[model samples]
Target: MKVMVIVRATKSSEAGEMPSEQLLTEMGNFNEELSKAGIFLAAEGLHPSSNGARIRFSGKDRTVTDGPFTETKELIAGFWLWKVSSMQEAIDWVTRCPNPMTEDSDIEIRQVFEFDDFGEALTPELREQEERVQTEVAERNNNAQGIPASKDEDEIRSLAKAWSGSLESKDVDAMLTGYSEDILLYDVKPPYRLKGLEAYRANWEACLPYFPAKMKSEHRDFTVTVDGDVAFAHGLHHVVPIDEESPVGQTWLRITIGYQRTEGEWRVMHEHVSVPFDPMTEKVSYITDEVIAETI
Candidate 1:
């Protein structure tokens, strides 16, 4: 079972007080133990709420609120992601952890949801997407210490092609695998832009189902340019669906991807996808082969 061990914030933590060196050393030793036991997957401490903000939603309206939120006892100061054989095992591990704060602090352990936990909500396709995402995450972690020294345009283009293929498969995880952790995306949809792989993945999850089961994403006029560890590509991509009844039976979209060689792999750092719009009609012009040829 996977669990998240949450360290609840105390008055001192909310006041932006740092942990003492002795406590830090004790915690570091505990972390090392967790690592040796293979129970630790990830762990991190959070900055105080004073530096954070929250977006509250009601209907279609969103309200942004800055923080330095009250209720320090309810806030989380840090957390650890761990995998163990059972909940009891997780409990045992948490009990062994050092007190993370100078004041009275509490730790809450909750099980993390697995793909199988979703049951019927996760179709075979969705399950496959999840698996692909997991594989990509594993690969990224494995390559963390092996960053390549040279640029390879061909390899970069191949990586781009794989990402495009994932779009056709509606494999959100596979598509996201090509992007960096801090990927910036200017999408055709609302919200103007998206930052981070998690946001991009969520965007795909919400959009992919609208596409047909068997779709084909064809790339044309593809161009790739490389400069040292950085590369960029631009292309016209068309989405064709197997079912004629689908709302987007056939549509064209423009795509520009920025890649940076990181950890021996080409990962997308930025992506901008858009459709041209006519100012006169205030409507998008969905380009087709004829339109593309004429524009060229």
Candidate 2:
């Protein structure tokens, strides 16, 4: 259960009747205690309503209502969000809150309705949109704060990093560990779907000599989503041949790899490699601005 505690202090309470300095200090200390106890989700205080305003729109006719209106008792000056096991738990915590005004003041604690509370009224699409919004908000917050990636993300990244290391070491067996036995590797060249583990291994072995000097590969736009025993990773694989300047090596190729969780590890179950397609001709080949201009 989650609850929002709204604190309102009347103008008379703060008109030379502000909460004592001792009480103010205690409020700050109490907030700190709440944070340390891991019960505080968020908390913020707002200046008097004089600094705020409300707008009303009726049939495109706008009306502005400035604050410091005579209804201080109904105004909100501060709020604290708390998540607990039940509404009673939230009420119990709110009961311990210190007086926020010199004269007695009212602090309203209301239980916030959870998504599950909607029951049959909650649509799947609405839940998904809500989740997406929350995910975006969290990502934006992390970007703004420069926080490190989440643990699950870092774990998947570590798998890719280890796979890269194995490729650098030319450890075919270790590299193959990232693929499932039912893997289907598709490339632009012939034998597109390198079906099954044995076939994939054989094809890789045959192609090893062609890439004798080893290959340097990097992934971009990488993302992995895992659910239960299944997981997938799809990204552009940028590869460069170390020795031969052949077709794939000479030109850049983008590859998409799909993975599945075998047991507890991530394994590549499918791969699609290709380059840019000719938009006008619908052909899989490199196209540039010069080519497009010439065609036009």
List per-prediction Cα lDDT, in the order shown. 0.80, 0.68
- Residue 14 CA error for candidate 2 (Å)? 6.5
Structure candidate 1, residue pairs in collision: 147-264, 148-264
At residue 260, candidate 2 shows an lDDT of 63
Number of colliding residue pairs in each model: 2, 0
Query: For candidate 2, what is the lDDT?
Result: 0.68
Show model 1 residue runs off by greater than 4 Å. 147-296
Top of the candidates by lDDT: 1
Ten-residue segment with the worst summed lDDT in candidate 2? Answer: 287-296
The Cα RMSD of model 2 versus the native structure comes to: 20.3
User: What residue runs in model 2 are displaced by over 4 Å at the alpha carbon?
Assistant: 12-21, 57-61, 149-296
lDDT of 2 by residue, 1-296 (tens): 56898887677543434556899898987786465333577888777777678889999799999866667778777799975544555665677778877667888888888899999778999999987887788788888999743645545656675566566556778777767788888876787577888887787667666653656554544666766555666655544565566554444456566766656666778878777767899877663334434865
Tell me the tens digit of each residue's lDDT in model 1 across 84-113: 656766776777788898877899999999
